[model samples]
Target: MDCEILENTVLLAIVTLISVVQNIFFAFKVENESKIANSKSSQKTSSPAFDKVYTANQNCTDAYPTFLALLWCAGIFCSQGPAAFAGIMYLCVRQKYFVGYLGENTQITPGYIFGKRVVLFLFLMSMAGILNYYIGVFFGSDVKMYIKAVSNTVSPFLLIP
Candidate 1:
C-alpha cells in the first residue's frame, strides 16, 4: 500500500481506538453511577452522573457514523493532513464534551460550544472535499492534481471556504 494510505489508515485506526476507549469509560461510569444513584435515599427520580453518562453515550453513538463519513470523505477527496487534523479535533472535542457533561452545572459547559464548532468544521471539510472530487471527475481532471493546484494558490484558511 502507498505510504500515505498506510499513514491515513493508522490515523483512522487510532481515532477509532480513542472512540472505543471513551465508550468503555463512559459505560463503566454509567454502570457505577447507576448503582449508586439507585441506592441513594433521594435518588429514585434521577442521578446526575447516570443521566450525564447515558446522554453522552447516546450522543457519541449518534455522532459516530457522521464522524467516520466525514473523516473518510475529507481524507480521500481533499487531503489527509487536514482530514486527520479535523478528525483528531473532533475526538478531542467529543471527549471534552463528555467530561464537561458530568459537571453539576451541565447546562453551562464550554464543551458544547467547542464541540459544535468542531462538527461544523468537519462538515465544511467534507463538503469541500466532495465538491472537489465531483468537479475533478466531471471535468476529466485528476482530483488530487486539481486539489494540489488549488492548494498551491489558495490560502490555507480559504481552503475550507
Candidate 2:
C-alpha cells in the first residue's frame, strides 16, 4: 500500500484507540462517582457525568462508519497526501470534541463543525476522483496523465518530514 494511505489507516486506528480509551476512562470516572461496581448497573444511574461521557462516546461511535468510509474512499480514489492530512485534522477535532463534551456541551461546537467540514471535504475529493476515473475509462482521457501532471505540480508543496 502507499505510505500515505498507510499513514491515514494508522490515523484511523489511532482515532478508534482514542475513543476506546476515553470510554474506558470515563466509565471508570462514572463508576467512581456513582459508587457503582457493576458496569451494567452503573449505566442505569442518572448522573450528569455519566450522561456526558456516554453521549460523547456514543456520538463518536455513531459517526465512525461514515468517517471510515470517507477516509478510505478519499484515500483510495483521491490523492492520499491530502486525504491523510484531512484524516489527521479529523482526528484532532474529534479529540477536541470528546474532551470538550466532557467539560461542557456548548464547547463542542467548534470541533463538531470542523469535523463535519473535514468529512465534507473528503466526500468532495472522493467524488472528484471517482468522476475522473469513470471519465477516463469511458472517454480514454488518460487519468494517469492527469494524475501525473497534478502530482508534479503539487508534490513540492506536499513534502513533509
Q: Which lDDT tens digits does candidate 1 get at residues 4-106?
A: 6787577666766777787788788788888888888564776666787888778777888888877777666666665666677777777777777776556
Give the Cα-based TM-score of candidate 2 against the true structure: 0.69
Q: Against the true structure, candidate 1 has what lDDT? A: 0.68
Looking at model 1, the pairs that clash are: none
Backbone clashes in candidate 2 total 0
Model 1 residue 66 distance off true place after TM-score fit, in angstroms:
1.3
Error of 2 at 15 (Å): 7.3
Over 4 Å off, model 2: 1-44, 143-161
lDDT of 1 at 18: 78
lDDT for 53 (candidate 2): 67
Worst 10 residues of 2 by lDDT: 152-161
- Show how many residue pairs clash in every candidate, following the order shown: 0, 0
Write model 2 residue lDDT over 41-96, tens digit each, in one string.
74565567667766777787688778878877776676666666676677777778
